[model samples]
Target: MPSVNRLLHPSEAAKRLGVSAKALRLYEQRGLVEPGRTEAGWRAYGQEEMDRAAEIVALRALGLSLAQVKRVLEGDSQGLEPTLAAHQAALEAQLRQLARTVEKVRGLRSDLMQGRAPTVDELMNLQAPLREVRVAFELPWPWGGELFELRDIRSLNYIIGPLGSGKTRLAHSLAEALPNAAMLALERLEDDGVTAAKSRMDSDPILKSRVDEAISWLVEDGANSSDALVVLLAGLEADGPDALVVDMIEQGLDHATQEALIAWLRRRGANARPLFMLTRSCAILDLSAVGPDETIILCPANHSPPMQVAPYPGAPGYEAVATCLASPEVRARTAGVVAWRPSSGRLQSLTP
Candidate 1:
């Protein structure tokens, strides 16, 4: 009798899961997913591994980061109740904000119909009534150097730094400091490699159609080029003379996407000014991906100048921000609304 055929090889497994061999290795490195290994030390994948791999691939395909995937998969599926509860609470807050926003828009529409020009002050007053409902907390501005206000610049700013550098924390503080602003958590986006790979899969007409639909939704959902910039600017204008904080988890964005993002930002900067808090591995702003802008000096928390390089290598400005915000003294000194708190996960406001 013929010997039973073994399950798929690593390469075939990757293909079946719609991921690259490298990604599989990375997943293994993170201990999030594992595959069988042969006595010869070669990687082997069985049906169970394939199923897990498919789940990993699908979660990633839905724009979850590897870290998030780990949390979802290995993180107390039985105890996911707490996370689910947190998410539900957050969603309810967003719903309240959206309801208020709709009312404001309706009032503005009625004013327009009555032939009244909506002044900035009038619009702001309309929004201010809802502000009283939010709790006030303080996050001292990060990097206490000198803030050089650049006026008439575009209404969306993107700041990038490596992980654990404090960008996310700083962004949360900034969002709290700026009234009428909304903070969005950035999801992963497809880079050139993934886009090309997906395009290649178009050889299968059915798969291609599905891929196209996914791409369309990704952009429309505010993860793509035009929509991302557009929504950023629109949010700023609607929020009024304030900043918007985007908590970006930069995962699959490649060089080309970075360049396109920079160019778009520059064009917008020419008109209105906004603040962006981007956290990532490298500074794509200075790269050939887009035209470079002069680095404006922001005041550091200790009155120190913004260093040309990260004071701590690999960490960057985020560290400075984190150090300041995490201080109990600084937290006490902060005035105005503090929307997010990293430690307790308590958010004071319900604005979307």
Candidate 2:
């Protein structure tokens, strides 16, 4: 008898589900969904498995924890109340914003009827709220003063380059140029500094609550708890600064942690503020998993001006960007390894 076939592979399932293959692995780890093993021992998602995974993904979209999702799946409705309330509040806020936008549109139409035309900027802003948000500056030290201007910045952006490529300077320049933006570098390593940071969190219940929730989610998603994770989450959950530029986002994270962290960062909702993260870890900057709302900026090794790199192959700077990325395991192996910088400020080192 012929065997019945036609189950999707993890990558195909992930593509259809609008999530990363890593996410499906995490879901399986959390006992959320189980895919079938093929005759060759490969995981295959049949219809039943896909349906279950889809339910878990939907619950996650509603901001439900994996544990909470399991509870709901097991016929326990208790965890739904708070999540639904928060979802309702977010929807209501969006409704209010839409009402204001409608009022603006009506006024614009009235002006048109009265023979008054709206400016291009006004029309663009009306059509796309974020269109007016722009970043413009000159390329910094490593390159000559080349003008750079970016409009409609996405929520998650990556700045990647080889060592001594001056990605750090570019990140700092971005933070300085963006209005109401802040930079969180990897400089808080001293014992005293860690203690002080924890003390601040312990003192502020509200801040502590936000940080704790973020930590719990990351931990549940297979990330290891560490001082580095805590510091990053504190900045991410803090209630100030419209945008953030993070230096070396995967600095102290392990392989699993880096995978989980990037997955979590990608799940930030549509209204999430812009984030410009500098990273070379392949896990953190997985070209395959990049979505429409993410952008990649590559700093060339030849000290040329930084330019945006498309996720696809053959695009300008795509190979350079790809060559710069290393798996988290490889990166960890090379941790604390540095190349000597020469008089020209260019360091000689192969990609990690």
Candidate 3:
């Protein structure tokens, strides 16, 4: 066994604490952790630092902001009540979902013992919640008038594909087909668009309040206010839309912002309005964060019909979805690099 008093390198310390080395550095920067230094000037985390870092990580896992974490670490409990309440609500929602799944499994097992085999659709239904909304329509251009049927739309649905894969077309079609759904387009970020969005927010006090709360939450997660984000949030929290299809939901937002946005959406629980978000950013489409009330649809590079992809690592089209998504850091590095497509040739030329 390792010595209890032994100090560890940054990577080893982070491993023990179940966090990233970058996160350790962030804590140090925020003055939440103070590590010793080697003679070579490398950071060294001793037992004291490790213990403190563990506390920070626990607070963060509870959705506390870094600032809030700092405050709590300094013995301030004034803000803990609301944060804990939110966490409790989220936990309760998850427990309810789990209970429903357990009941379904029990029923299925009972059927099996009685010499009854469940249908494929019935088996699949046991895995996910019954979708409350669905859309069926003919796919638009690039796809040859193929009928597309999206069943059991979840609270959060991600529409993802590479450039020229017709993901945008799918999103638009979904917006038109879903009852009372509207698409929040990129044009919302154009000049005077922000002003119009702000004007709408001003006209509605409840919406403005919700928007402000969301913005504050995002800021706590390291997001800064931008016209694009504000406009997007305005539409997300807007009244009267049964659902919303958002094109490039991560547009103009940084990695932190995307992470925060997804977390916030997940916490909205099962009753949140359904959202169809088109995204290429890994942060926004995190495979690990896809919940029971979430679904993923991938438009293949070959322009085949879009299909819902199971989020598991080895599921069909899961690799393709993973390939199409990039970390925000990688996205930032390749922001201007676009794949070349010949305008007048057979689409086959663009394949692999």
Candidate 4:
């Protein structure tokens, strides 16, 4: 237990609470927990604040959205059932795995009793590995049919690169190659997609309900309502494909909405399906907030094969990844900027 009078800086508090400082800021933005201000006016968390944050973290771990957490903290249990079910499913999966391990151990003991020695491979097979979601396919256009193979996919993957890089093609190949994966493209932000999304929502009451609930949650966390948000959430319902690839997830969202949407996506916890998002917004991929379950894939400017990048300053391609990400404000300002392929040239030119 921490001392009652002890005060922790935001980073220290986040470390102690096993979360990111960005998460703490989001909690504050949602008015879920209020920390104190030191003489320098920096946010400081006391013991009480730590305890409150711990509660919020536990609720979030159970797959409750921020709005759901707010409601539960306010003494209403309105929306806990679905989240609780999801949490239970995760726990039951673990339980089944444990049972299998127990059976393996029992078989090992039986073999010992029969004076039989276990083989090396048999001994190694006692423990189960995490799910291996892999995709392998020939590279799409721009490259000369290079083989691309990706394995050990994480829950949250970001695909990033500069404007003219083949990142978009790579994302497309991934969407086409991955089993049961679908790409929610930039069309989701277009007027036709918005109208079709609304029509789908109108026809599917369950999808509409989920979207409404998610929108309500985002709205409470400083997001404004727009067709962009509606269509995005509609495409991202829990009942969608096994994996989703999003192209420019922050395409039409404002700063506040982008921030809130990212926070919400992170809070989805175990209920979140694997998402491969091609992002250029800093808010959508905060390097400091990248967690164990997140992976960053970067496409190089020179058209070298896309590679996984470690989320640290000194890693290879880290600078390029950082350069690809622009603040939401910057992204909004440059929304109308377009690059062109000049006439008659095998070699591309950025020289104007």
lDDT of 3 by residue, 51-137 (tens): 888888888878777778888888888768877998898788778988988998899899999999888988877667533677899
lDDT of 1: 0.47
> How well does candidate 1 score on lDDT at residue 327?
22
Model 4 clash pairs? none
The CA lDDT of each predicted structure is: 0.47, 0.83, 0.85, 0.85
Highest TM-score against the true fold, candidate: 2
Worst 10 residues of 4 by lDDT: 342-351
TM-score of each: 0.30, 0.87, 0.70, 0.83
Q: Which stretches of candidate 1 lie over 4 Å from their true place?
A: 1-162, 187-242, 249-252, 281-283, 287-352
Model 2: lDDT to the true structure: 0.83
- Candidate 4 RMSD to the correct structure: 4.0
After superposition, the stretches of candidate 2 with alpha carbons farther than 4 Å from their true spots are: 1-5, 130-132, 339-352
Question: What is the lDDT ranking, best to worst?
Answer: 4, 3, 2, 1
Worst lDDT 10-window in candidate 3: 125-134
lDDT of 4: 0.85
Query: Distance (Å) between predicted and true CA of 169, model 2?
Result: 0.2
- For 1-352, candidate 2 gives per-residue lDDT tens digits of 1122579999988888888897798789888999999999999998888888889988888877677788889999984776688788878877877887898899999999999999997786676743235899998898788998788688899999999898999999999999999888777555665676688788888888988877777776677999988888877877788999998899888988887787677666556789999998999998877888899999899988888988988999999999999998898898789976565434434434
